[model samples]
Each structure stands twice: as C-alpha cells, then as structure tokens.
Target: MPTDIAFLAIAEAQQLYHWLPAALELARRPDVRVSILSPSDQILALVESYDPTGSLRRVRLRRPPSRPDSLFRQPSRLATLLLNYPTIARFPTLVTTEISSAWLRRVPGFRSRLILIKHGAGDREGGYKKRHRDFDLTLVAGEKDRRRMIDRGLCTAETVAVGGYPKFDLKADRQRFFPDDKPVLLYNPHFDPALSSWINHGPAMLAALESLTDWNVIIAPHTKLAIKAPPIVSSAPHIRVDMGSRHSIDMSYTMSADVYLGDVSSQVYEFLIQPRPCIFLNLDHRDASGDAFAHWKLGQVIERADALPQALARANDLQPGFVAAQEAAMQQSIDLSPVPASQRQADLILNFAKKGV
Candidate 1:
C-alpha cells in the first residue's frame, strides 16, 4: 500500500536553495504525494514557479473570505491547523522543518515519527534546538551540524547526517553563466539578528560594496530579510541585486561567485563548497558569540566598512584558502562522497515513507 505523505512548508520556501531541491527531488516520485501551504499571492507565485500546472495539490487553511493582513485573522490560515490537526493526529509518520515545529507540538495526539531537517547553519544565537526531541529522525547537512545539534541537545544522539542541501546536486557541473573575464562577488547576508544583517547597518554595508571596481557583485541576502522591505539593487555597471524576488531554493548565483561576503548565512557554507574566498562583516563589531558557522573558521572579518576596499584587494590577492576551508566544512557537515546528494536525500525520504505504509 502507498502511504499518503504530505510535505508542508509555512510558506513557499521551497523555491530557494535549501528546501526546494529536496522537495522537488521527493515530488518526482509517483508514490509520494506532496502539498504546500501559502497564505499570500507572493507565496502562491513562488509555488507556481515550481509546479505551474497546479498539479501539485496544496492545502489551503480555511479562512474567512476577507483578506486578513494578519496571519491570526486569516480564516484560511486557521483552516490549516484545523485541517492538519486531524491528518497529523492520525498519520503514522509526519515530517516538518523547524518553521512549523511549534504548530506540530500543539496538534492533538500528533507528535510521533517526525523528522526535523536542519535548515540553517546551527548556532546558539539561532535558538539551536533547546527542546522538542520528539523527532525520530533529524536530517543534518554534515558532522559539524550533527555535533552542534547533539551538543546543544537540539535533537537526540540518534540524529542522522543525511549530507548537505539537496540543492548542491547541481554543483557537480561547470557551466559558466557569464564570460570568465571578471571576478564575481556574491553578497549573501544572513537574516538573524545575532548572526546576520538585521542588527548591523544592512543598507550601509551594501552601499560600501558598491564602490568596488572590476568585479561583478550579486546581492543575495537571506530570504526572510526581504519581508521588511524588498532589497534595492544599486551599484556601478558591475553589480546586480537579486532583491527583486526571493530565491528560497535557487543558488546558482552563489555557486558561481568568485568570492562571498556576509555574516552567518548558510549560503556561505554552500558557497564555500566551491572553495572561494569569503569575508565576514563585523558591521557592529560585536563578537558573534556562540555562532556555529562563525566557528567554522573559513574567512576574514572586516570591522569597518572603510576596510572593505582593502579587504577586497586582499581577497583577490590571496590564494583561495576560504574556499578550501569551506570544502572541508562541507564534507564535515554534508557528504562529500561521489554519490548524488539530492537523490540520496530523496531515497531516504521515500524509504522513511515506505516504512510508515
């Protein structure tokens, strides 16, 4: 018998690099039935970008016809919990990411056989899993994350390392998007306050990078960072801002950049897989106390925006040590073996679903 499995996301985060590829790989299977939930048109647009035919059945939260700006007022939003409560309550197995963990805990009699996929680079600041070890399996990118999850007690010692983001499955090839004439700089800022752009002067940090010459810059900040205001793309002819839309699963820009600049965003780890130079901006100059990705020891930290020009110069002058360190960390956090990562993760999800049947 085929088990009825539903994959839920709080919003359309599946379009970006971390979650979407895994979801896409899983959705390709005939046995697995996947669904998504999005309360807004923006999210719906992202969903359509993936499954445009409306072939992918998505669950809509029951809500009053009035479009409530607040999630609390949306009847459709309310319907999600009311609807999922029963499905989750009776389903033999449930898999979700941390974004929906709080809701899952509230579901009546529905907290067994759960899987929590570690989404970001773990850290004490990102509220690294202090509670709710109810998950039977925790999908981690690599050993470093596994150690932090275990050390922080985010999950039990039984958690398994499934390798890095299924998105990296595309990195095995060497297709160039642009002519290899100029070096490309990918600015991947983190969304967390303690680990990223929210606390530091975000707009200023970006403006400073605008002055650089010769290199092409791609401003690919964290997805959540755009909720406040869409990122404004500005720069000399060499720069391009990816702020027009959020890329929840697309990371080809990050993979192709020659250098990376940002705080604790996990894309740094992903960019590091190619072993390019990465620079950390200590925008506020505050110590990133207990940030797990910061501890990865891959790049340099610039304390002042004025130092950026020199930092870029140094970044270009030096051999790619940061890239090599990122590769090492990638192996430790995800499997560096020759096998395809997306297929590996898809197989694991399918096998888990099969057992429930």
Candidate 2:
C-alpha cells in the first residue's frame, strides 16, 4: 500500500513560502506521495517556478468569492477543505501552516491527522491560544513555545515537537531595494489594529523618517494590512513603502536591514537571527512587565510618536545595551539545529504517520 501525505497552502500566496521548503523535503521521500492544495494562482505559479518538473502533486482549489452572500462566503481555507473532502480524506495526514486547519477535525468522517507548522516565532499572545491545542501535533520553533504551551495546559509535551522554523531553509536573494549604501531600516508593523502601531502613529512615523537622511527606510507592513487599506507612501528619496509585495515575504528586508522597527510582528525574531538593533512601537502603552510583552525586552520601546526621532537617532548607542538580551531571546525563540529544519519536519511527519499519537 502507498503512504499518502498532503500539505495545505490555504492562505495568502506569501504564506506558501513558509511550507514550500518542507513540502519539497517530504516529496523527496520514496514512500511518501506529497500533494499541495492552494487556492491562489499566484501560489501555484510560485510552486511551479520552484519545481519545474512537477515532482509534487498540485491541486488548485477555488478562491473564495468577494461578495459576502456568495456560495463560497466562508474563507478559502475552510471552504476548500470542505469541497475537496473526498480527495483530502484519502490521505492519512494533512499538514498546514495556518491555525484554522484545526477546524478540519470537525468535518464528518474526516480521520486525517492534522499537523500544524507555525509560520513565525514571535512572543505574541495569540500563539498561546487553546485552538493550537486542537491539532494532533504542533511543530514549534523552539523551547520557549513548547514550554509556554505545556505550562498553560494547552497541550502535552509529547503532542508538541521542537523543530526549528522551516522557512529558514528557504534562502532569499540579495536584491538591493535601496539606492545608496546608507543603513537600511525595515519598518515592519503588524496588522492588528489593537496591537499595531500603524492605526494611530503610522503616518506620523513615516513623516518623521522622511526628515532623517542618515537611513534608508522601508515601510513593509504585514501582508494582511494591505488587503484592507492602502499603505502610507512617501516621495522622499530615502524612504520606500511596500504593501504586501513578493519582496515583503521573501525575507529580503529582514536580511538586508541594519535596524528593525515594528510592533507585535514575528518578523522581528527573523531579523534578530543576527542580533541587530531593534525598536518596538508600543501604541497602547501596555506595561512591559508581562510575559506577552517579553519581546519588548529585546529592543528599545517607544510609546509616543514624538519620541521616535530621538530613538532612531540614538539607536546605535542604545543597541549595545540590548545586544545581550537580544542574543538570549534569539536562542529561546528559534532552535538552530545542525540538521535542516525541513528535513527534520519531514521525518517527524513520517514518524507520526507511522505511529499514531
């Protein structure tokens, strides 16, 4: 009998990058038949570009209709899974990077094992929710997440595995987005209106950066932010505004930037892979003593827009103070394993399929 496995790429095209590396790794197994389900044509094109030979099976699910009352009113992830139940049910295991995949357990006669591979390694409160415990097995980035989930009674230690982030294996090309060699500042804000700095201080923050000639600023907000509204742009030679472009998710800005500025975005952990200067915007003025705000300890936190200019000016001087803390946080957030993360995840999936939890 053949062993079947499926990888679900049900969200934005950018999210595909998070699972592509691991999917390819699993496809290489002789006994494993890998299938990819995506609703976005752009995501399909990306997968084709990555694997021209069509080594892995690709299924194009229908995109959700824009109108609320349309037949596919629900989001594409849940809708696609329901529509393709017959084909999806054939597989013994289904893998996804989205938390919403937990809903798969609700489908009647759906006995497939759900494995969740989280997209980021941030310390946000959303990562510790009860929904995460619904999956049969969740692959996390490091010990911090595993410990947090177990301590909160979300899941048992055996149910959660400590595999490094798979996206790290997918390398980004060194494309110069800036004109000059000036230090690059990547301003990556989260999409949440409550925790994000974009809602209240984004415009003023961009205007302030335009006045500074010392840094080349790149305003690359979270991809979901562009889906709702237009991003703030500037004509200034030193600043560039990008709203959910291919470059935004390709890790280009994270790798090229000298400094990081954001609020509640997991990409900050990606940038901290090298322990660079970081500045976090606290729009709600929340106390930093809690565990949810642990990431704030990695950088200088500025609560007001007026103080941003001075913070940016003195970033270099303040960076040294946070270096030790950033390094410690980086270790706790990600597990830099000797083996590739994709290979490790593929092995875990195969092992889990053979021995049910």
Candidate 3:
C-alpha cells in the first residue's frame, strides 16, 4: 500500500530547507504519496525553485482569516495549523522540522504519525527539548545530534537513524552579491535570544562589518530574527546586509562566501561544507570548555568586535591549521553517503510508516 506522507513547510521559510529535499526525494517514488503544505506563498515559491525539474506538486495552505491591526499583528503559526487541521489530519505520516507540531497529538482522534527532522545542527540546549520525545520518529542530520539525544536520555541508538543533512541536497545557484572579487565573509548568527551573538552585538557588529574596506561582508542572521529586526543602512558598497532574504535561506551566502563569521549558529556547519576560513565571536567571553561552545574549536575565536579585522587578516593563514579538524568534525557530524541524504531519509521514513514498528 502506498503510504500517505506530507511534509510541513508551515514554519519559517528558513526551516523549509531542512525537510523539503527529503519530501522531494520521496515524490519520485510510486509507493509513497508526498504532499508539500505551507501557508506562505514565499515558502511555496521557494519549493518550486528547488524543483525546477517540476517533480513535486504543492498545496498552498490558507493562513488565518484577516483581523484588524489592533487585533492581530501577525497570524500565529498554530492558528494556521488549527485552521488546516481537517486537511492535515488526513495524512498517515507527517514529516516536519518544527516540534511545535506536537500540538497535533492533543487534537481529538488525531492518529497521524509525527516525524521531526533536525533543522539546525547546533549545540544550544534548546535543540534538545523534552517535547522532542513526543514524535513517533525523529530524523537527524548527523551523529553529533544522535549522541547528544541519547546522552540526554531522549532516545536510544535504535530510536534514531544517522540520516545525513538534507539541506546539502539543495543545489546552489550562486548569486554574486559584490562587484569586486574580494573574499566574501558571511556573518550568520542564531536567533536564540540567549545564545545569539546578534541580540547583544548585532548593531555594533554591523558597525564593525560596515567599516571593513578590504573584504565583502554579508550580514545574514537567522530567519526568526528577521521578523522584527530593525532596518540597517550600510555605507560601504561591499557590505551587503541581508536580514532575511530568500538568498539568506537558500544556501546562496553559504556557497558564495569564502569565510564564516558567527557566534552560535548551526549555519556554520553549512559554511564548513567547503572548509573555508572561519572566525567565531565570543564577545561576551563565554567558557570555551562548555559543551554549548564546543563548535568554536573549528576556527579562530575572538573576544571583541574590534578583533574581527585582525581575525579576518589571519583567517586564511590560520585556516589551513583548522582544515583537518573541520573535515574530521564534518565526517563525525554529518553522514556522508553514496546515496543522497534525502533518499536515505525518505526511505527510512516510508519504511517506518509501512512497518508500523
């Protein structure tokens, strides 16, 4: 029997990258029926961008009904889910990147199997929430997360599979953002209020990056922060500040950039894909020995924004020193497979649904 599967792109557009590839991979199969659901046209359009070959069909889910500005600032995601509950309840298996979907279980007579795909491979404590156990099946991008989950008693080795990063399945279009061919530095920060380098250092960091006359800088933070981020005007022509454009989420900056500058964002893993120069900001002077700060070992760590220039100056020279470690980390974290990650992940999901084990 063909398993009815739906991939939820109902979250932020940035998260859609994590699950859509696997959904597209499953679309090519005759035994698995796949549907892509989203409330944002931006998300739907992004889905089509990835499927230029026209392999998957999309359903534009309706957002909550309009209300006055005084009543509703923006529609809640949960409202969208509740409004579409009747339609969402029809699928036997639902694959999503957000854990907030656990709300589906509280609905009366809802029996759909829920699967969580890791969106960002980060070490923040928020990554291992207790609600994670609510899912019937969980798919992770790497062994690093699997080990963390098990160590936290969230799952056993048998409960999770070492599925590779699905975002890697995205083909890069490589948009050239700058006119001169100077090396590009992508300064991506996480949105987590507690761990984000942006909440405290964002404005000043912008000032620091704006002053860089030698290197081209791309200020692309996490999509969640983009929701209410203040407008930033850059004086330098080479300093391109992208709060959250489609290019920010579509691997454009990751592929185009030559160096990575960040604090605690998992996009660093994506940046490390090419093993270029990397510099991490520890401006607040956090303990380096802590598990949350473990990934800082991948590159040079600076204590202040003014140090950014010096760090970038020596990034390439110090890059070769860290390349071997970066390669080893990526090897242990992401499962590099002969078969594409999306195919492996989709096969695991469909097989899990079919066996009902």
Candidate 4:
C-alpha cells in the first residue's frame, strides 16, 4: 500500500529536528500512514534516534555512484534530486523543511502536493525565497513570517498556517559547561559572509570574552560555520568553544546560557524563549532600521568588541525595559497554545492530504 504522507528529510541535521515532531504526531493517528524519506544515512540514523519505537517508517532514496566536483557546482545535491524523482512521485502529499525541495515541482510528471514547514524563525531576507511560492502549503513559526509571505505574495492566508516552532517540542538533555555559577554568555554568530560578525570581529570578540573575569562564556557559532571553517579553540578556563557538535544543534547551549550574545543569527529567537538578557553585535555597521534585525531592539546593540564590558554590565538591568517588548516579539515570532505545535501541524497536513490535491 502507498504511504498517505511522506516527510522528505533531505537537509542537514540541524533542520531535521524542526519537522520530525510533526511527522511523529501524524504517525500516532491510525488513519494516517506517515513515512520519512531521505538519501542520507546520517539523517536516517538521527530520525531513528527520535522515533525509537519505529513509528516513523523510513525509506532511503538513491545517491549517484560517483561524481566529480568543479569550482562552480557540486553534483551531489543535484544528483540526489534527479535520482530520487521516482520515489518522490509515489507519495500523495509531501512535506519538507527545505525550500530547495520545491525544485522537484518542475519534473515532467510529478503530481504530489508540496508542503513546507520552515526550519528557522530568523528575520533574514534569505528566509523569504521566491521558490517558496511553489509549495501548495506553508507552515511558519510565527505571524511574522505569515505576514511577510502574504506581503511578498509567496503564500496566502489560507495556504499558510501559524505553526509554532516544532523544534521547541523536542526535548534534549540539558548540560552544564561551567563549574561555577557565574553568568553564562552564549556568543553565537551566523555563517553568512555579508552579515556575520565572526568574519571580521571573531578574534576580537573572543578577546573581549577573555577579559571578563565575572562571566562564563560559550563561544558557539552557527552549525553551518563549522562545515568549512577550522574548529575555534579557547584555552580560557571560563570560556568554552564549540564549532559544531551535537550540543550546538540540540539546544544545549541555548538552554544553558544566561545572557545571549550574537550578531544576526536566528538562534537569538531561540535564546529569547525564556526572556533573558540579550546583546546584539553590529560590527559590520549595517543599517538597523530594517525589519530583518527587529530582534535587536529587544536588548542593547553594540558596534564593537570594545563595548562588551559596558554592555555586559547593563544587559540584565535593561531587561525590564525590554522584557515587555521581548514577550511581544515572541508572540509575533511564534504561535503557542494548549495544543502542541506538532499536533497543529499534523492536523493541517492530514487535512491537506484528505483533499487529495
């Protein structure tokens, strides 16, 4: 028998946690048969770790036997796209966390309805791609994205659902990186060259943290940065540096940190879940008036590493002035309720599947 709905888990592991909860929720209902499809053994293994009871059935897609790389293009992803066309054709409705999967809509005989559940709730312009319109339905973390989708004509009110962050539904072990209870600062930076503070201000940022005797620091950059860059190391007893590890992607650092410090990574929103002190870096000196950096208003915004001492001194005290705004922004950025986000997403997916579009 054909699967009623299949989740295409073809992206990086960081993105996997975002959509897995909804798939597991769908599997609980007897009327719906849900399966997870992927070409990556690593992704499949991670999926199994979450669905240990074998609730989310797995199907492995094919990969090219061998392919040469050139300066402009790597064929691995494109090859996977071509090789998996037949498998993608079998499902009635397909749900994925990746926007690139929309490329499959161009296939000659493809008939499955495409549904997208965005992985991140960041405010970067990259999140609003033209390709998003290709999907039949979209699920976003908050009303912030839903409004942008409608404003950009990427999706309509009916086609998009305000699904809260499904990744929040996932629970990971909390870890303590520091021996003492000094305030912990999580310094996470984005990988984007145009926006990242690490490219130009990283070493200086680390130096600023080392100068602080009153704080414990976790210098965890975005997971994508560790992909091509060398591992960042810190020898300071109070400072811990993680380039990319399971702890980085699993919310270990975000949950453990007391003060949030970063440039423009979306992880700031994740850190804001508890409404703690947040400090944003504007090292590149970009214009701050844009909506892309709206979260910056929730806390102090500094332009250089030299300002760290003064900013850290005031971050917590300033929270009362910003807490109300932070809470308001959280409501704008995520939809929360008595019903779990996973179930809400599953309800939408199942209803879409029932339509036989």
Q: Candidates' lDDT values, in order?
A: 0.61, 0.80, 0.81, 0.84
TM-score of each: 0.79, 0.93, 0.93, 0.94
Q: Name the 10 consecutive residues with the lowest summed lDDT in model 4.
A: 66-75
Q: Looking at candidate 2, what is the lDDT of residue 101?
A: 76
Q: Number of the top candidate by TM-score? A: 4
Quote model 1's TM-score.
0.79
Per residue, candidate 2 scores C-alpha lDDT tens digits across 171-267 of 5755688778988889998877777888667677777778778888999998888755565778999998888667788788899888899988999
Clashes of 3: 0
TM-score of 4: 0.94
Give per-residue CA lDDT, model 3, range 1-357, as digits (tens). Answer: 677788877777778778888888888888777888877666677788778877776877777874421111335668878999988888888889988888888899998899889777776777888878778888887888898888988777777787898888884766789888888989888777766777877777877898888889888887777544565568788898777667887789999999999988888888878789888988888887876777799999998898899899888889889999998878777877878888999888888878762
Native-to-model Cα distance after best TM-score fit, residue 204 in candidate 1, in Å: 4.1
TM value for model 2: 0.93
**Residue runs of model 3 more than 4 Å from their true location after superposition:** 52-54, 66-74
On the 0 to 100 scale, the lDDT of residue 81 in model 1 is 52
Query: Which pairs clash in the backbone of model 2?
Result: none
Error of 1 at 200 (Å): 2.6
The per-residue C-alpha lDDT of model 4 at residue 80 equals 74
